[model samples]
Target chain A: MTDGILTPDQILSAAQDVLRRYGPAKATVVDVARALGVSHGSVYRHFPSKTALREAVTQRWLDQAHAELATVLASDAPAGVRLREWLGALFRSKRKRALDDPELFATYVSLVTESSQVVEGHVADLVGQIRQIVDAGLARGEFAAPDPAATARAVFDAAVRFHNPAHAAEWSRPGIEDDFTALCDLILLGLEVR
Target chain B: MTDGILTPDQILSAAQDVLRRYGPAKATVVDVARALGVSHGSVYRHFPSKTALREAVTQRWLDQAHAELATVLASDAPAGVRLREWLGALFRSKRKRALDDPELFATYVSLVTESSQVVEGHVADLVGQIRQIVDAGLARGEFAAPDPAATARAVFDAAVRFHNPAHAAEWSRPGIEDDFTALCDLILLGLEVR
Candidate 1:
């Protein structure tokens, strides 16, 4: 109903709630504007296009997950432990979203389906987190990867079974935790090779 | 068309053709039977249920891929080369399947989605193949993995992006080949740590 006063961040925040209520397919800019009590033109002024707004929401959702892992990455734990915890955190975070809020997770999955670039950016951010842990390990002489960034990528891809949305169904099966730990150990062993 | 003369193999061959022609969702046992000029009863006799028939077709499809890689695994080449070639073959095989026969591959993806057990068995077979290669490498003192089976699983999970149908869209992205090679090199380094 009003404009000029509501920040773009506030509109995105309101859009997320509208998105959750309406779901991705039905959610519209006017609905987001209505939720924010602002004119549709105001929402358009901030995002320029509905796609941009949805993408921003996607990025915001991803960044929330990224922020959780950032804490682990920034912690002073040993690099190896930090690496393990970093990956564990990512898996748990995704699983929580999937299990706790299935509808919202479905909405995000739709958003990701519509925009591969969002998933790519999310993955890039994850790899960057892993790289930090790896670089720390290499500096501490606890790991021997030739390229920290490449190793970060390999580690991320290797654990896709547990974290990748595609294989989410498999994550709930019995003994999956064991599989995760076993793979992590193998990677850690490979990382610790001196 | 005579029940006494028509072998199960012939029925399966016709089923493959019918599945390809109609796609999995519309394809039926009667269609398969009709294709072979036999009664649906004959098809039902070989496969007790439609699920069983679809599963058998899925297994048949997977076996084709397995048979190709089995040759690489069973070769007399060094284990390192064999492992690299084995992974390369798997990625290439999957890529070929995804690209060469999009319809059949889509049918296979749908089948796998319906039957997790089939996918589980396929993964087991692949992990078994990797285990054999790892065991051989360890025996020859070319690799140092403590658990060849677990290592094989790690390697399989790591290279999943290249092989998993869910990530088919990303496989065609520019620089994906480099990403594959980089990850493979990282896994190889981990395996070769002595």
Candidate 2:
């Protein structure tokens, strides 16, 4: 493809592929350009530096989960059911990526470590989503949280291991599913109206 | 002092000091030996290798917390109060290490990464302590848990960010104390008999 034909989206897609194949340490903008049949300059035009490229890809990867969780957030189900679904979906989505899509997941993890701001934004976004869920639960009188925002953050902190990429190593351990369930069960119990 | 003047406990103390001063990458058996006025060979005779020394230091650091927490565990206080104190003390101990003792905390984090088994044993030890607390709560009809062991593990998992070395960077953030309290409040609510 010609230089002008290379869009940021196209570059990001190819960058993701290159990152997955070579891992973050080895992958470069030049490799991404090579995969896309474009000059490295073209890729640079879209993303000022390789760091920007990696950050964009990490953002894109997390955005997929954001969208997936958004569905659970907007569902018509009761707050308790929706909260349960949200927690399970978040855990399952990450666990699946870690176990079944190992390469891309590894790439995502590396990109995340390099892009602290991106990870921070992703975490804030996830916390905000939880806030909305808590708000809904409170509005429906299904949950009791004296401070919804703090409750939201507390909930995320409580369940950090199951969904945080840093804890991915523990996901595949035997009985982790049970552990995850038990933790979530405790969290949900904590959130319920008592 | 003779060559056999050194004991593993003494060597571990000197190693911990060296690790705190220079960090894991820079600290070595030689530094610990020099601190003790002995040859590195003497330190090796007790610790075997630098990795073993690091692990021993890490274990020692954790053992301090274990001993402190064991007091809370063995207290005649009600299970709810003991659990609350245990969670708060655990968080406070780690948070203090991360914020107040910067160098040693960094060394501990690095040593933890190198000494997974030691960390695992510490976690299991903590969970076992939590189990005893849960068992007391169950016996006194102060808590409701289908599986006491799972409840203990879940409690540990819930407050992991407060104590886990991986989250040390977040220890000094503004409002973190409130976050810790909020999470513990929620966790205590979860453990309550409703």
Candidate 3:
């Protein structure tokens, strides 16, 4: 209802809705503005370009992921439980997003490979957070691994690799999650000293 | 060069060379014929269509992989060593194909997903071969796990996931093969009981 008082959050929420409906490739700024019931110029006022709008949408997703992880990390649950829950949530969320808006998911994955410094920074930050958890486990003698960072990287890569859209069709078969959990448990077992 | 008695192996060889040079998407029967210094009509004499030629090329690769696995399994080496070598060869060959001819690699990957029956047959055959090795190891107490079929599927899926061209840049990093070996070691460690 407010013309000039629309917040960035409002803009991003509207953009996400448009993304879900039309996908990232076809969701233009004008379409987003139309969905928001606002003038096309108002969308540009918040996001300078379509790429910026798409980036914001991706950043919002990442922010949500970080927020979820923070909640899990703050809980009284054991580190192993927290880590498993976090990964499960991550996988489910990615799968949902992929199914809801494949174009956006494809764009996000492409960004991971594209030589973009900003995307690399975001990825590195996420990796660093996972590494911290692994390091904490190793410090308490909970893990037997010599290289916590490497193990963390491997786990992160495995989770993402398993959830890839191309892999997901077959990977979504019966007992797939059970198999994934088994793999994760194996990693944890390997990290645990006898 | 012989017009009247071209073997299937020779046809496949010519196709592979053409694929390497022109990529899977651009490689046509005419191109394969030109590469072999034969008339297009002669090429058509052996293969009915471009799709048939592509299938022949893929089948050739599959045969090579099967032959290699057979040799590794029949070797007198220890199971663990055999597994490591087999996985190393698998990963290396996939990486080489992805880098050397990305279009063809993409086409092959697409083919697996394009038809469920085709992929199921391919997976079944591959799993059967790997299961034999795992079964032997289990009988000898070298492997502690019993579900060799499922484990074989996981290994094959992981290899496919890791060797994706999308991940090639990451895999090209120094000591990536070492990282993959570490991952394999983790899998092996998890397979062992105790």
Considering every candidate listed, which one attains the maximal lDDT?
2
> Regarding lDDT, does 1 or 2 come out ahead?
2
Worst 10 residues of 1 chain B by lDDT: B185-194
Query: Residue A28 lDDT in model 1?
Result: 97
Instruction: Please write out the lDDT profile of model 1 over residues B11-40, one tens digit for every residue.
Output: 777878998899887999989988988888
Please identify model 2 stretches exceeding 4 Å from their true place.
A3-5, A21-31, A39-52, A101-103, B3-7, B18-35, B38-55
TM-score for each prediction? 0.93, 0.86, 0.77
**What's candidate 1's i-RMS value?**
1.4
lDDT per residue (tens digit) for residues A56-157 in model 2: 888888887566788898898988788778888899899888999877887788778777798779888888988888999899999988888888899889
**Candidate with better DockQ, 2 vs 3:** 2
User: For candidate 2, what is the interface RMSD?
Assistant: 0.7
Candidate 1 clash total?
3
Candidate 1, residue A96: Cα displacement in angstroms equals: 0.7
Q: List-wise, what DockQ does each model earn? A: 0.63, 0.71, 0.34
lDDT for model 2, on a 0 to 1 scale? 0.85
On a 0 to 100 scale, what is the lDDT of residue B129 in model 2? Answer: 89
Question: Per-chain TM-score of chain B, candidate 2?
Answer: 0.91
C-alpha displacement of B61 in model 2, angstroms? 1.6
